[model samples]
Target: MPLYKTLDPNSQTHVKIWKITETYEDLLQPLSLKPESLERVSGMKSELHQRGFLSVRHLLRAFGYTDLDLYYDEMGKPHLKDGMHISITHSFTFAAVAISDVEVGIDIEKQRDKIAVIAHKFIDYEFDYLNKYADDYIRNLTVIWCVKESLYKLFATPGMLFREHFFVIPFTLEDEETISWIDYKGQKCRFNASFLEFEGFTCAFTLPS
Candidate 1:
């Protein structure tokens, strides 16, 4: 099992990352998936996606749970059968999960120049602090994107615009963590977000304040 890293951010929260070096068949051998899960995996067109899905199940096993202990809502947000708050994310060669007693969300994204092209779609208030010509432009953009995505997952509300409703407070790359807010439908909430970079990918996670 390529369990890349396990983090206990707090006493009540568990974060696990898996580096997917195993083939589809190798990842499939040790687990039994629910009928729906099997069907879902079978329908995935990408082998990398399939491996990411199965690797998550293995991550669950590391947490003393299994495919049987997870389910998704109508919004497609995953939930734990036992009621612990959970969020999952998977990118090209990486998969991650975050579970906490409090509400949480997680995301992993490969750092790429392409995100710079689409940054405007998801960034608003953050632009004031962003310098496109800066050396860390791509890295900063990736963090902002992941931060908004994590907030979106935690909010799970329909029609929430990332540019209009989500805002990430400014912070230098050295900060590693910062505060963000969700303002939508006349309600406001704050969250604490942190990020890390490894092997050219950025992983960001949020916990409600």
Candidate 2:
């Protein structure tokens, strides 16, 4: 089994992580999917994206959810039949999902140096805190990118320009974990975020505070 790190904090949020691996297909065999759902996903060009959904669905099934129990809203945000908050994401090889009684969001990304070239597009206020040294730039960019992506998924609102609004507090890249706040439309939402380095990929997730 892939390692699952679960944090059931006493402080109003619960989180868990399942690292994606080559065995993702095997793990998905137990999930029963409807023909309609397959037809819907079949149009996606990336086989990786399709498998990511399969892995996510398997995890939800293990948590006692059936295929038809999950639905997406008009904005393409997911909703649970039982009314639980849900968020999902998949990178090149990993897929992640977060569920909470309170609203939640999660994101995973493969660490890549290319993010630095486009940092100015998705990052603004976070730049001041990032290490400008070439060796540290990519890792720093990855963390900030992951943080913003998580916030985007959490808010599930269109027209969210990352550079214009998202801001990550200053912290050492070596810390591996941090707590941050997001200012969205006058609401200051607290987030607890952490980074994991595995198999040359980096992933991060946040839950409401």
Candidate 3:
């Protein structure tokens, strides 16, 4: 499929999503990827991952960019050739890209019961407001995971651990928004975390507070 959805939180930021319904050859034939990128995708063990990689490239085209115009840092964070801040994520059958003039990160995750098992690994302060018995417990956990992952990508700094450094403020599913903090080394930074749910998946992005 073509671009599945596009979001604009402000004049300078754009988030685009893609649903990967095309076959590997269908996705690969349209775009021009550098040799390294071709080799990179060719080495993938799963076709699902390969399609996810191609889908993100198609998203860049939706924003008038090409695969060559995108690059990654040593931290594995994505960047644009024009100095724009960018984040890319793909999970299961979906892929998304976010671009902004300011620091930003984005993530998409499938809402699954399995997230609860690893909750303690990346969750700390959020537990205070989270009730395990609530009907929305799993949904809430998915959102928190999505938000924190985005923050991690946006911060893109080594030595930052989610449980130790990221704290999400209280939020409800209806609100679709929240505040999050990065506290480490006695220094703290704030960010705005916003999210949406569709097709049993949640996508979250972070920007300056």
Q: By the TM-score metric, which is better: model 2 or model 3?
A: 3
Worst 10 residues of 2 by lDDT: 7-16
Writing each residue's lDDT as its tens digit, candidate 3 over 1-209 gives 57899999999999999999999999999999999999999999999999999999999999999999999889888888899999999999999999999999999999999999999999988899899999999999999989989999998889999898999999999999999999989989999999999999999999998
Candidate lDDT values, in order: 0.93, 0.73, 0.94
lDDT of 2 at 81: 89
When summed lDDT is taken over every stretch of 10 residues in candidate 1, the lowest stretch is: 1-10
81-132: candidate 1 lDDT, tens digit per residue: 8999999999999999999999999999999999989998999899999999
lDDT of 2: 0.73
The TM-scores, one per candidate, come to 0.98, 0.85, 0.98
| lDDT comparing candidate 1 with the true structure | 0.93
Preferred candidate (lDDT higher): 1 or 2: 1
* Positional deviation of residue 112's Cα in model 3 after best superposition, in angstroms: 0.7
After TM-score superposition, the amount by which residue 1's alpha carbon in candidate 2 deviates from its true location, in angstroms, is: 5.2
What is the TM-score of candidate 3? 0.98
